[model samples]
Target chain A: MSTKSTQIRLAARPVGEPQDSDFEFVTTELPALGDGQVLLRTVYLSLDPYMRGRMSAAKSYAKPVEVGDVMVGATVCEVVESRSPKRGVGDLVLAYTGWQTYAVAEAHHTRRLDPGAAPISTALGVLGMPGFTAYAGLLEIGRPQPGETVVVAAASGPVGSAVGQIAKVKGARAVGIAGGAEKCRALLEEFGFDAAVDHRSATFRDDLEAATPDGVDVYFENVGGPVSAAVVRRLNKFARVPVCGLVANYNATEAPPGPDRLPGFLGAILTLSLTVRGFIQDEFVPTRHDDFLREMAGWLRDGSVRYREDIVEGLEQTPDAFRGLLVGRNFGKLLVRVGEDLTRE
Target chain B: MSTKSTQIRLAARPVGEPQDSDFEFVTTELPALGDGQVLLRTVYLSLDPYMRGRMSAAKSYAKPVEVGDVMVGATVCEVVESRSPKRGVGDLVLAYTGWQTYAVAEAHHTRRLDPGAAPISTALGVLGMPGFTAYAGLLEIGRPQPGETVVVAAASGPVGSAVGQIAKVKGARAVGIAGGAEKCRALLEEFGFDAAVDHRSATFRDDLEAATPDGVDVYFENVGGPVSAAVVRRLNKFARVPVCGLVANYNATEAPPGPDRLPGFLGAILTLSLTVRGFIQDEFVPTRHDDFLREMAGWLRDGSVRYREDIVEGLEQTPDAFRGLLVGRNFGKLLVRVGEDLTRE
Candidate 1:
């Protein structure tokens, strides 16, 4: 096993879209594992839109990643050296080792992943934070009733796909909004969304209107921009918006210019009685984690839910892949294959 | 008794602030009372901020008052002539009589008021829609826990005052924001608010900062403008905003100028995990009305809650009184005395 670890750290905060100059690659000697700790080799590093927020000096639910600090993220890893009974060598586990090929993590901080039950990488995608965000935010805050229409953007991505499928499981009519025709097609074919609207099309507004003839009841807001503005107009009275992310605005350098729509939005809130709630998934883990693990596993087993992953080849592609994430360049749950999956070998 | 009702009708939609020309005084002859109907003499006509929305063609929770139609409003009335067994002549009751001296309404449409229990005028203010609005919106949506800080603007008005008092009743510290020093004084002294900030003062923001030592947990939003914007900045994580009104924007002719703030506000919702919920008081009538009546009656009886009123003389004064209501000229619940209260005599 290699005694040195190659890691990516934040070099400087980016102005808008993150660039290559924003990241610094470093090689460091791995410290000897302490008691109750495991030295893990990263097999997959999850790349998400929220990483964009962490890269900036912005006030968010989580603290911004400081310059020169290792970029924060969730990773699926293989424990290579174990000093605790909780984990053994060659055991695959879900860990938050960030953007590094190797990390010495406390054994209790990691959860064992059963490869036989499901693919180990599924622990970082459909069975992980993103999936739990869909489960808790939709069911707890959105509260979609039977026959109600639910609209979500970034429809081909992990959270959005899970939201649509779960909305279906709850007997709701799911409408997916994606940037391209291909993603929209996948929303209907692979994810089983009731309808899909291509937001990139010139007739997007009309398409959205036709798709949501009954009006939207639950809007699982993952991407915010003109698409969200259009969707807000189609919301029914007493509609619930569980805002989990705003990928479209994550790279914005300044506020958009125009006849300020804040007052107008507040007017709609008062007149239509809308509920707009923002949340971080961790807040729900204490209450809904067990339910999410059990129900999502059943859905995966029964084909009630399906997930797709877009895996890049190496750790060095982190910066570019993340930028692509904010712009919806890569579809599915974007991940970086930091090292070889030795278990599969 | 005169067989005519002199009313102020909507002449035309106002450009910004409502003007005298926008209202037309019309004297209409009353139709003969039919079975199950009563001739009601309007004693107190409530002039609220919502009336401004009714005068315009803007989309709102309720329909706008049509041009050439009598301006709609709630009123306390005396039954002058009855043809139904449900009500008797000289009984004090609550009715939707608009800005008129007399209205012929079905007896079943009016709720009989017991003058011995409370002042009959309160049936239109503290014990009416405004009171219920504060009750249901604050309790159901705001849900301020004990030891939390609750903030409200237009704190001298019926709804705002009731919201502050009720927050205190729930064991939360109440902070009030009002337009003038006198109103702020009333908020602290009369309404028993823990702290009061004068929005008209130059030190308004600083005062608000000092007032809410513990960040706001619940914001009962009745007035929306700079006051609300400032309060939002002071909100703690997971704060709740029960938006019941936006009186400041009711007369806005067009959307405000460049640098749209909607995105920033939504960003705040995301980062702080805030819940911004809008509601019409009537939605809670079925679920919370009985509890409100019982609790509010007890609070008033035991002096736990206190109310104030600003009564304008004559139905003809409604137009000016209503215009004043939009600008916070009236200090308390604004009402027009349309006719002499025969029961008081």
Candidate 2:
């Protein structure tokens, strides 16, 4: 059986911050499920900063979505029909089905989720890519030791929140940096970060200094700009930085104004004996994915780790929701309810 | 009996290139040997780019050489008199005696060298700290896999020369970047590097491209400047950079002009999944020293690795020799023969 799919495609490469005119929406019938394939009906679509990179033709770890192609993303969906013995109708599964209402994917390509265990939508958030990114980047690259101070910016968001919480679990002091007083409060109170500094404050640098009494040891770098520049100065000797994302510069049309700080940073790196490693989460899937699933599950069950979601109501809201994700407008794990979640009903 | 010691003290912190006036020469009576101490007659004094950092009050891994203090460095010294069982009269040993004609040091602090195994001056260059810096940083951090392309700057110097040879020993393709055609010739003919690119040539970038047909997988970053910026662009996905030194920017009084390239570098790091690690060799002494000594000895004996020294005749030439070392004037490991080698007799 075939189903109609409403999709958003990249219309043009964004010059800077993506505008509405850069995306084109279309409706079409999806191809019938093949022999080892299942027909997926999208329920929740994730909106993330990485989407900005995919919208442009700039060089990145992943290939950009083409002009006429559906904007790619992680989606939690329900299997409506199946031609394979692996999946049954109405089974909830996690898939890379992009920003569309319906998709046909191979059974082996998607992982079935147990809705009875936790909220199915979490497959796109805390239990998914963002969570895994924090897990792999922190444990492998950052390697924060007990009593060491581990700092992360955008701390109210899914990846940063997970990073801080995981660092706490590893017995390190977790210091978080976020945009506003409210997000800072969430970081300290809800996310259980030992300290939280508001980056938007006029006294942000001083606030960061006050928060991290002991110098930073592991900086989980997900945001770049003045915030990262200030944090780098406060890093202790033998510090480690795991660069996962740079949301601040994703929309930059041109290089920022001079005096180039690269040499100074390199100098600091040499004098301090620092390690700065950049990574994409998918690279860790083979070795660390199983451990992440097991440990994170326990953290979630025991209430040691908590998460929040900012769920938008409709599929059409994806563009605006994504724009919000880039500028610190979304408070938590941002998700778009693309269609009805049958399992919730 | 007693002898007078001639020393060079830092008269002033240099603004750019260190001038002869920045150093003050003084002669003083050597103190009588105390218990567990040896009176050392300096033979070969090592002069390296790191000395520039020590002349300044800027924060670094090691303490700065305070004004009016004898400049600190590694030296090959003779045990003319001893009050300890660890050293006997006429024995040659490695010592941290700085730029001086004679010194009194604890016997326990010096490592006795076997003149029969190799030349005594080698204890300050190829068989000493600089050689170990190349070995530990490249093997530990760079981790060049077989058939991978490894690039190093200052390829004719002790550290870079050893780095290229060691990379070749590990079955990786070695590409050397040096200042002049003569050094580039030495890199290919004398050092056995697979390819050599002269950074001073007008077509350097194009030459580098021609050398590394497959991209660079490992970059041993010693000289940080325009050459480093160019090498950074040629790095492939998952490249590793072991930043042991930054000689090019060591003399700069102020930050180079704009637009700042730090963001772009960090962006490339993220997209390429690079590992940029900075280290001082002393940190690895506890763990990798034994292996380095054994393996490096084997490589040297088997003709898999070779090194050259540019020895200056007198102690007074240090100031000029050091100034030349910073600007790539020295062809190899720059050393000063501070006094007569009694072992030659």
Candidate 3:
């Protein structure tokens, strides 16, 4: 095994769509682990839409990734060596190892995942941050009551998929909006959503209206743009919108031209008594994270929840996979298979 | 006594600022009071900015007044004749008398107000709907903590003045914004706000920045326009905004030009974890109206909460007074003294 680790470092902040020139590949010798630190080999590196926000120097909920830093991501890793009693050499763990093949982290920073319990890659998808985001933002903010209609865009993606399924679990009707027929089909078939509308259809707005005949009660706002505008019009009185991400505009170089819709938006918020809240998953850690873990694990075990992954073959495909994410090119949770999984081996 | 009652009814929906041509005044004999009903002599007709929403045929939180219907408003009335044991002749009551000189109301529809306990005019001002709006929207939605900055616009108006005074009462720093120096002075001197910024000043943004040294935590949004855009830039993380009214845009015929601020606004909501809620004061009647009356009455009794009135005489002047309200012409709670207040006279 190579003692040197390879990493993709940010070369420049992209103006719009990230290009290969925006990232630099580097190979560096791994430093010896310190006391209470574990050496982790990256088996899967999670590439998420939020990373797009982090790449920009603009102010956001979290600090932006500085230039020349390893492109930040969550990773499922195999503990290759341990300097603490908390983790063993072959244990599977979840760590924020970024876009790297190997990383060293304090043992406290890693969470051990039982290999026999589920696939370790699930740690990068449904049972991880994306899942937690959907669970917290939907239940805590979107708050779909039983029989209420819940509408979500990017319904084939991890966060959106989970939101639709969880709305079903809570006895709410789930109506999903996705880009194509295939994704719309998956939303209905795989996620068990009550209705699926193709956002890319020429009659997108009409399709949304047809799907949500009673008007939407909870809108899990993952993909913002025209889809959001259409969804907002159909929101029932007292609708709750949990704004988790706006992947559609993450790569825009400038603001959209407008007859400023904000006033109209605020008007809807007032006249409809809508609750529009924006959040990241961490806020609910103290209150709901444990409940999420226990409930999510049970659901996954009982086949009540299902997840799909769109894995790229190598770390070099990170930029391309991420570009595809912004344009709805990926069918599921996008992740890079950075290295071979030793957990199963 | 004029046996005939005079009323101002909606003749047409105005394009921008309401015009006299939009209203038609008519004198008609009121129906005879029946069992459990009282003939109320309109002593004070309250003219609020929300009346503008009712004038429009557009969809809103409340149903709009149809053309030829009497314009809706709250009033302090005297029981001229009572057919129910619950109320007697010469007693003052709070009633929805609209823009009229007299109204016959069911006893159940009116609340008895003691002129001996407080000024009866207050039932239409600080102790009435506008006062409760600030109380409920600020406390329930804004949730300002002690030492945190709470900002409100239209500072000298009934709703804004109450928000500032109540925020100060709660140990929060109160910053008020008004359109002119006179109103700004009233905010600081009469209302006892910590700081008052003139939204019409050339240095308005700078004044707002200087006033809110600690970023704003609670923004009682009574006015929405350029002033709001400036205040929003300084909101803190986890800041709460209780959108009670948008008086600034109540007269807007077209949406303002923009670099589509909705995206930037949504981005801020996400990054700051903001809770943006729009509410009509009625939602809190079953929840908090009693507490408001008790606490506000105590505050008034002890001279802690000071109220101002811009009383315009005669129901015939409601259109002009209401027009003045939209432009900040009336400094305080705009009330039309439609009839003799025999409770004191």
Per-residue lDDT of B1-345 in model 1, one digit per residue for the tens?
448888888999888999999999999999999999999989999999988888878778889889999989999999989999999998999999898898999999999999999999998888999999999999999998999999999999999999999999999999999988789889988999999999999999999999998889999988898999999999999999999999998889999996988888989998999999999989999999999999999999988899999998988888888889999999899988888875667
Candidate 2 C-alpha lDDT tens digits along B1-345: 988999999999999999888999999998898999999999999999999999999889899999999999999999999999989999999999998999999999999999988889888888889999999999999999999999999999999999999999999999999998999999999999999999999999999999999999999999999999999999999999999999999999898889989999999999999999999999999999989888888888999999999989888899999999999999989999888876667
The worst-scoring run of ten residues by lDDT in candidate 1 chain A lies at A336-345
Give one digit per residue, the lDDT tens place, for model 3 in A259-297.
899899888888888888889899999999899989999
Steric clash count of candidate 3: 0
Q: Please identify model 2 stretches exceeding 4 Å from their true place.
A: none
Error of 2 at A262 (Å): 0.6
| Clashing residue pairs found in predicted model 3 | none
Question: Order of candidates by TM-score, top first?
Answer: 1, 2, 3
Name the 10 consecutive residues with the lowest summed lDDT in model 2 chain B.
B336-345
lDDT of 3 by residue, B11-70 (tens): 999999998899999999887778999998899999998899999988999999999999
Q: List residue ranges in candidate 1 displaced over 4 A.
A: B343-345
Measured by DockQ, the strongest candidate is 2
Which ranges in model 3 have alpha carbons more than 4 Å from their true place? Answer: none
